[model samples]
Target: MMMMLNNEESEIVKDEKSPCEKPIKLIELSEKPRVYRIPNFLSDEECTHLIESSKNKLRPCNEISSGVHRSGWGLFMKEGEEDHPITQNVFKKMKSFVNLTDSCEVMQVIRYNPGEETSSHFDYFNPLTTNGSMKIGLYGQRVCTILMYLCDVEEGGETSFPEVGVKVKPIKGDAVLFYNCKPNGDVDPLSLHQGDPVIKGTKWIAIKLINQKQQPSNNNNKEGSCAP
Candidate 1:
């Protein structure tokens, strides 16, 4: 069960026990979609820094090989890697808002330009495993994903979830927080989302933070990747 209590309303979302069961709310986009958008989630200065840093990391790729042609930016946080300052701060804030038990890792920073959009897909992490041991299943667990919009979009660039019929446009300094997996570690099918094509200007952005364990487990793999 996921609960959010505020002065206006207390939101409690219950996950289905079976992995094959469909999400309860089908018509409403916001109802139990596991997606939350927070406007002005980052400061103006912080947003600018993230954009600059990510721009310097962009990598050219073969567009024709894939369905779309787009560039990518990435930064990984290992045990001793220099962490992105913004990502470190956001991770701390996220811990307070949600219940997390394991150490979190910084995955990648991604940006999409005009005519670029990610196809619908689900974010999945490898099942927890110890050193050369059998994988310890942590199915249906919730994995946190945070996206901070670095640049504003004029038109046609929106994050859309076709399963729930939800579309979120890019707003500078705002962030969208979502859970990639469900309470039982089963990846939520309704959470499948995609980036709409950028018709006007380039879509600049950065993603900060990934999963933190909510309970002690033997799982070791903790890397995350994204496509634009």
Candidate 2:
């Protein structure tokens, strides 16, 4: 099911969905270079609830560093795994907004504290097997990323695509969706992004969407490696 926000009431405008219907006007950001703001994407109550849930479920900051070689907060979910009800609902809504399928997975939930930032990097285009080798023909291409900001930042901590000179601030209940790969399965250079260091209070949280269906193979193993 898909829902729209009235923008005025700041309430969730629910829309009944047919079995396989997709949401409308889920704009493609890669095709354009602008932030598509959906005001009140989550209601005030929903935002409060999510904050509480995150606080309750907060894992050690070191856990997130283990994955991205950066200091931050993170929680992971397998391709089809649905653990938390709140997270599941958020993921479903995101998928509906982009018309994503089961192949596109909710990879992680991440938060950045003051002074934390990820160096600019492009997502690897291939998936590594359990044995550390690249999947033969099953390399997963990252299509788009849905970064739903869960809290307001006091300063700094904007998601910056330096290559394109674009910066996105953290806004509660607002999502910044962008394409990381071209339709032809090429990684877009402009998608190289970094989390600017938070200068004041903690930057709170965001979601990283990984689309596995469009990933490429580690043919050369030249620049992009799947290892930590």
Candidate 3:
């Protein structure tokens, strides 16, 4: 059965005033899964800062599941690091682009070396899988994702939706936002995507995943919720 959005979930998409200093523009990439390309989402300095901070902290990324293949390195910020200036600044800009409430999951900086790529996958939880079910039981569903490109890839490294034939090239300081679930909270299969192999230069991206419910870590007297 498809779950419907409750008042709290509906509030997440309300058109609130942007918290940006500069004008914000959204370039539509796809409609079925509601994908958009945001240019200059991050400044050059912010991108450089994130890359620098993550350089010494990267570790091989974990696979989504036992058999799934995911290639890349990841640097996940510790809990309190959200107060760090670089991340705080990016989070502020992200709000201007998406009407997000409740604290977000920690940002993960990902690095893909030449020839590295993640096989196609869905960002939404697959309830049939044990890991997915466990995750959902704890954090609710991942309803949206905002990916920030920290550097340009000379040759490949495109975020591709094979089912839709949509490809977004990596451009420094740009961001791509996409919905993983419908307004009624059903997982959207059209949101399936992959990180194409980087052929020339490396690819660096920062990921922001928003869940349907607020996480326990951020439940400290915060007024808003992430739920339906």
Candidate 4:
């Protein structure tokens, strides 16, 4: 369908499904690491709201090699991911895209400036490597990540998957998704990815990680108290 806007248009009705939340058309970008990309995931309004909520609380990102500061978007965005009307609405909407309702990590908002970039890393846990282990999740495993682009970059800032030779550009409202583990719960090394250096303009993004929820253990057993 062609998207056209005219001055005579009074109001544009929103679609039932988000521009990028179509579950049926979930495209697979990689099979080894189970990567996917959904175009136009978030809307322009949603992106702006998230950025506004965390504009003042940005902090310097931690880097191992050089504890010194790097020239990133300088906007380490966060907040409004919880207890906000817009957040609740979007969180509930995301439920329609994947299972495991009680299994999402806090949403993270991040911005990157030209020449800034993050090192390659894996989101899932691995028992073999010290750096690959995840110790602070309330779940079994990190499953999927829904990364949305808040704004566009003029030159660079593509999401690069070096292992699979994939690089996704930063387009406002689009999203990149990928699984960190296989069906049997083993971490996939092919999922390794990193934020490529930004070349020209500022790059804004929001990321949410989904995990396998830890099943509540029923340790206590009780006798039947119900009436027959």
Task: Identify the leading candidate in terms of TM-score.
Answer: 3
Ranking by TM-score: 3, 4, 1, 2
Question: Which tens-of-lDDT digit does each residue in 1-228 have in candidate 3?
Answer: 112235421212323465566655566778887887778889998999899988888776653223345678776676676678877878887766555555455677889999988788887777888977877776778788888899999999999988789899999999888898988888899998889999999999988877777666654222111110
Clashes of 4: 3
Q: What is candidate 2's TM-score against the reference?
A: 0.67
Candidate number with greatest lDDT = 3
Clashing pairs in 4: 72-113, 73-112, 73-113
lDDT digits (tens) for residues 121-208 of candidate 4: 7776555655334432334466777788889999999988899898888899787778878878877888888888899999888777
Please list the residue runs of candidate 2 whose C-alpha ends up more than 4 Å from where it truly belongs after superposition: 1-37, 56-69, 78-84, 126-139, 214-228
lDDT of 2 by residue, 1-228 (tens): 444455532233235562223332332233433334444455455566556655645565565343444666655543333556655566566654565554454444566777777777655353344522243244346566666667788998888878767777777877766777665666666677778888887765555555555433232221222111
Error of 3 at 71 (Å): 2.2
Model 1's alpha-carbon lDDT is 0.56
lDDT of 3: 0.75
RMSD (Cα, Å) of model 4: 11.3
After aligning candidate 1 to the native by TM-score, how far in Å is the CA of 82 from where it should be? Answer: 5.5
Residue-level lDDT of model 1, residues 23-109, one tens digit each, is 111112265557776656566877777667556655543332244333443444344332467655555444444554453434445
